[model samples]
Target: MVLNKKGIIFSLLAIGLAGLFVLLFATGYQQRLDDQNDVIRARITSLDQGVDSFYDYAAEAQTIAGTAALDALYQEINQSGTFLTSDNFESNFTRCLNSSDGCENDLNLSVLLTNYSAIIATSLHADVQFSVNDVCLTQETFWDLVVRTNISISLTDTYAAWDTSRDITTTISTVGTYDPAYVAISASYGGAEDRRVFPTSIAPNSSRWNISTFMDFYKGRQYQASQNGSCLSDRYEGSWTSSFQGCNLESVVDADEHPRLKDPANQSITHMDWQVLTRDMHACHDPVTNPDDFRVSISDADDSLVLWNKDTIRYGLYPDHLDFSSPTYNAPGCP
Candidate 1:
């Protein structure tokens, strides 16, 4: 009986040790599962933050790209100051064509586009595209170019040119001072009888005596080149000098009129016009006619002179000089 009791005590001790091991394993497994769940939750939170960042980045990237486009537009405007003026435009265009190696002052398409694109790429891996209305500033279009960014937002404009023309024919108030020989030569060539003779009012020839001044009528020694009315003008700021009608061109442009986004809330937007005009100063002259057009006409009922569309038209000759009867014709005859 003493041996049996000792054996039972040993068996019970073994059972208790096995139960402690089972309890420890159950608690450890549960703790491991809890730790794994916490790790998963932290990962999920991190993923959500990443997604928010991506959205913000895309939106901010769009804003940056748009701003860059505006900067480019402003650059175009600043660089092309008064380039549309007749004097600057014609001369520069001619120079470009006459160049053998091509024009150095020609428009640089790559520079304009690449500069804009590089700025965006360096800041963010975004796409950008640029195109100009006219590659050479041909004065063909109102919009210099269109810039598209993020494949959605775009900016551009439309332009139209209007020219004013009117009749500018008038009788001369005075024949202006002329050399006696020149007067004699003019009278002999029927210049005095020319109703189309421009008065001493036009530019460069403002002090001229008659239309025969430009006529190659031999003044006995020198050959005269037909003097067309001309005005000296500088590009980028002003128009042609006018002693008669104003030689100005007007331009009007219209865009979608999109407001600039001043803040993120789409509020406090500012608007600006796309139109720019050649607002030149009025020319100095006597008895200022109309500033509306560069054309004019003058008449004395007997004869009429029309300076229309850059041409002089005469319907009749000076009074009594009809059929061209010189008061006193005395010349060595045609050479």
Candidate 2:
């Protein structure tokens, strides 16, 4: 009995110790799992914040770009008359780099600078083209002095966009009545196969010539008169020969040339051939006339006129023609 009792005690002690060990181990394991959970939660929160920050930055960038583009457009229109021509457009755009109140907001100005620099560089290297249709004349001599005229201007531009080619176009029509008395005479004399005269008209008498000839004479006189203030000594000036004096002029002539020679018989219809005097004027910018942060460039190409990265301005006479005015006929010397 004594030996059996001693064996039982030893067995009981071993079992008790094993149970304690297992309990302690289980407690430690649970604590470790809790610590790991906390770490994971902290990491996830940090990741979320980083993603939010990235989106905010992108949104800000977009806003800056959009505002800068609009502001630059407004400035360009206001200054179009002074510096927005084809000749000085590049230089004018460079001047826009200066940040004034109009373009000085830190974010917007920075965006403007970045984009404009790229645009200017591209424009400088880009190819441009322009064309004009000669004025078509439907009427001949009206009152032997005035002529009607019509003209068209076309421009076009081609360039690369995203490594691909693109094109834009602009067209304009200008009609006005002009006095033949003020027209410019070509270098050649005696209607000597002058290429300037088109759809030639001949009169029955030597004194009264066709409207085309009269217009040529008027144009020559106008140019000369512009320089000297008078149409005297012009080649078109000549004595009225016999037989031509009796011809009746068109009614349009009486409306164009009144006062003494308002006879209805003295008027006749004449068409004026139009020619382009000037094309591809350069862009310009004068700090004295306009004070702004951004610069602009304008060009006419492929029958399209562009104000370089901006909307067209309506402030000046030429640009105004873009919005208003249709072509009409008057004596070349009426002005």
Candidate 3:
């Protein structure tokens, strides 16, 4: 009888322990579910924010592009003999051709394009200057008058976006992880691990060649742009004629003492035929920049949106940057 009583007690204890295990497991699973739900919520929030922001982004970009006060201001500036000018723009581009063919005209298209979907972030400034009357330009005229322009973004902004993309992904990845790391960027997602990089520079013709890695960080918000066949090409035999009277460069003197830069002053040529597209863009931010460097009337825009002045537009196009600090989830089993 004593043996039977002891066995009964042992059975009770076993049943209680089993109940406790189930309770504890239930609680832990609920917590994990909550964590997973939180991540889903964050993803939803980010997407919703992007969706809601589309209108504002479009409006803001449009205001800068057309029919807004900024456009009016540009028009006013353009009219007041305050012509926006880009001059002496040399093609600081290197050949990215794989063919052993010569670099000349190897670029089938003058390309200055973002590889992914992009919206104008922060502030944008567009300036245009064309001649007042149709003018004939000979080799002498192109040398004399000059035609040039630039389309560029600041290095600070570019690098900031690069770094921030990784940071944000890292911050969002701490859930359900042993040691949290950043989200992985894949090649299809524009990951850049296969190429080479020069961490110290992004200069024109700086040979900042890295394999696919340079573009790995390109998250559609960032940029990789190239411009070619501008001002000098096979079409005009290297001479450019202008639709306006005389180019703005007519008033400017060469800061350099190169004899080839000297003006020929041969004004007798007529019927201009050749053309050039001065679309020079380099990404660099000087060490020192302030509110004035991005000069625009910042009335009621997002604080993050900035407008950079000419002086603030620095030259590095690709800075050597790689971070393994945040773990990369380049391949998530999740769709």
Candidate 4:
């Protein structure tokens, strides 16, 4: 009976020991699983931070680039009369092509570098693209002029109410008539001409008459008749007539009536007045008229760097899926 009791006690003790072992094993297994899960969460978090950092860097770069471009545009527009000659254009363009570090002095290279560096430092991969659009030269001109001349002539009766005389005075006067008429009835030989015989009458109802007048008597009728004659008559008339005849006087006196007569004969001679001419001329000479299109791509190979690995694994960093895109870059002379 005692032996049976000992066996029963031993069996109970064995069962208890087995239960403890099983409990310990399960607890250890659970702990290992928990540790693995924590590691994975931590890695994911680090990857997210790295990705954020990269994006921050890219944003900074884009801002710098945009500012630089704007500054360059302004400088080109407001530059002084040191006008961009063909040689200057070519030299500047060549420098840009050769990636000349000195070009920054003439342009806003500091801004570009800030942008480029920011992007390169933050991103696992990067590249640069530049381009230009259409360019054309424009020209314009401006001028001022003065003209001087003198002549003797019969003017239209613009102020008929103010004059009632056969003799027009030596004083200068302004008239606004389209036409006027006169008549002469003279009996004269070669004797000194008489002015009294000549009759200057403003027809009361004449549609074109503005004024009329009579002159003092003179010995020579020939001189009076000659005064009322046409411009050609003043040079060729040798004799005076006694018969009455009608005469018409017409003239044009405004020099400014024709406006376009003074303009530059051609565009090539007048381009300096236009503000855009300089820029267009430079672009034409430089041949930088169009911008080029480009694409930015990133692959897994770029993520192999230690920093990237640390971000991905230790820091749980991950990238925002690259926005694979074919983007366009435009500059001054691109089409």
Instruction: Write down the lDDT of every candidate, Cα atoms only.
Output: 0.28, 0.28, 0.24, 0.25
User: Which stretches of model 4 miss by more than 4 angstroms?
Assistant: 69-335
Model 1: lDDT to the true structure: 0.28
TM-score of each: 0.27, 0.24, 0.23, 0.27
Tens-digit per-residue lDDT, 123-242, candidate 2: 443322211112111111222211111212112223222221112121111112221221212111222111111122332222333333334433442111011111111112211111
Model 1 TM-score (2 dp): 0.27
Which parts of model 2 have CA positions greater than 4 angstroms off?
1-4, 69-105, 108-335
Tens-digit lDDT string for candidate 3 (1-335): 99999999999999999999999999999999999889767654544444334333322332222112212222222233222223311221111111112222222111111101133232211111111111112222211222111222221231122111110000011111110000111112232121111122232233342323222322211111112111211111123333233221111111121122222331111012101111111112232432121111111222111122333322112111222223222112111
Tell me the deviation in Å of residue 197 in model 1: 48
Model 3: residues with Cα > 4 Å off, grouped in runs:
27-31, 38-60, 63-335
Counting only residues 3 or more apart in sequence or on different chains, how many pairs clash (N, Cα, C under 3 Å) in candidate 1?
12
**Per model, how many backbone clashes are there?**
12, 63, 31, 42
Error of 2 at 157 (Å): 52
Local accuracy of candidate 1 as per-residue lDDT tens digits, 176-236 = 2111211211232333211111132223213332334322221212211111211111112
Candidate with the larger lDDT of 3 and 4 = 4
